[model samples]
Target: MAIKPSKGFIYLLIVAVFVFGVPSEAHAEPSYAKYGRAAMQETANRYPDANIIDYKYEGHFETSGARNEERFRLWLRGSGGEFGVRVHVYVAADTGQVRNVELEEIAR
Candidate 1:
């Protein structure tokens, strides 16, 4: 007997695809090397002649397992007493891209 797919089955299939189709970059990791590069560019773009001297990744890095979310935090510095910015960024380990960025420290 040739069994045909019911309308309900088709609808369920469609819904399943829709629900699990798009993937979030929640499992990605931030590239420690390029993180500084792009951040320097962004800082320069805003500051204009902002001399970035050094940077460091600070805080705890946690990966998603059962009790943590994948995230990393970094701190950046620039010339002329530029130790006023702490860049908190979250990244997805699967995509290796920044998921969120929080720039703390505004020049006064």
Candidate 2:
């Protein structure tokens, strides 16, 4: 008698590769709350009427294509209800740029 792999087992193996095999650096990076401060200031400058109470980098990921490009969502609040604004902010591994921003609402 010979042992055979189950269909479910093979599927799990494939998922594991996509999930843990690749490094995060290949796709995107994480962002924190402090990183959103600058965008808040800019928004404040652009839209004086709209008061930017808070903002944060939701996450970072490559969009459209790699090219080291990425879009990070910034949770924002002001005149409008709570929502997110995706912005183009890509920082290299050691670029000293905003990696990610933590959400204040969910911080606690």
Candidate 3:
């Protein structure tokens, strides 16, 4: 007589493959690093004479019906004084091309 596997045993094998075969970090991407570099460059352009003391990612926001942007707050110190500025970097989600940069000084 030929040996046969039970239905329960087949299901258990399938479950084990699914539980251990998938990579945990498969969805991780380096896109954030690129965005951070762009944000810092934008801040440097806005305040060429200032030194960047610190910065924080403020998350994502939609600027218009068709455009999305990443916001960052950069703390800077220059010859004049120390202050914080909000930098908005608009980039294409698909191509990663920088569309525009906008800066606003936050009240100290």
Candidate 4:
């Protein structure tokens, strides 16, 4: 006898591909490599002696109706100890100029 595919099996495969193939917003990485670099540069400027071990893009937030900022968390190792810092890279949406950078230490 010849083997044949079931209708249920075919439907399941289609459903699996539809669900798994689509990229979700939460799982997608932002196209903000330049912004991330700018944030890292600012972090380096602030902690000249500290070495950045790792970093991640937390996400972007709207500061105001007209302003939006990209947030990043940087892990650093210094002579004192290992610590994390949050960097807020503010940029103008219209002109794309870096407005300001705010750094805050993350408590362990």
Task: Encode model 4's per-residue lDDT on 30-107: one tens digit a residue.
Answer: 677789999999999999999999999999787886678999999999988999999998888777678898999995
Query: What TM-score fits each model?
Result: 0.44, 0.35, 0.65, 0.69
Q: How much is the lDDT of residue 32 in candidate 1?
A: 64
TM-score of 3: 0.65
Which parts of model 2 have CA positions greater than 4 angstroms off?
1-31, 53-56, 62-85, 98-108
Q: Would you list the C-alpha lDDT of every candidate in the order shown?
A: 0.56, 0.50, 0.83, 0.89
lDDT of 1 by residue, 12-100 (tens): 99999977896656745653656555555555565564565556655436656322222222333445555445565556656657666
Tell me the deviation in Å of residue 31 in model 2: 5.2
Off by over 4 Å in 3: 1-30
* TM-score between candidate 4 and the true structure: 0.69
Give per-residue CA lDDT, model 2, range 1-108, as digits (tens).
Answer: 999999999999999998899777656644433344555654456545544444444454544332233334445555655555555544444453644322223221
Question: 13 in model 4: Cα distance from truth in Å?
Answer: 32
For residue 64, model 3's alpha carbon misses the true position, in angstroms, by 3.7
lDDT of 3 by residue, 1-108 (tens): 998999999999999988797756766664555677888888898789999999898888876765779888889999998999988888776676778888899946
Q: Any idea what lDDT model 4 has?
A: 0.89
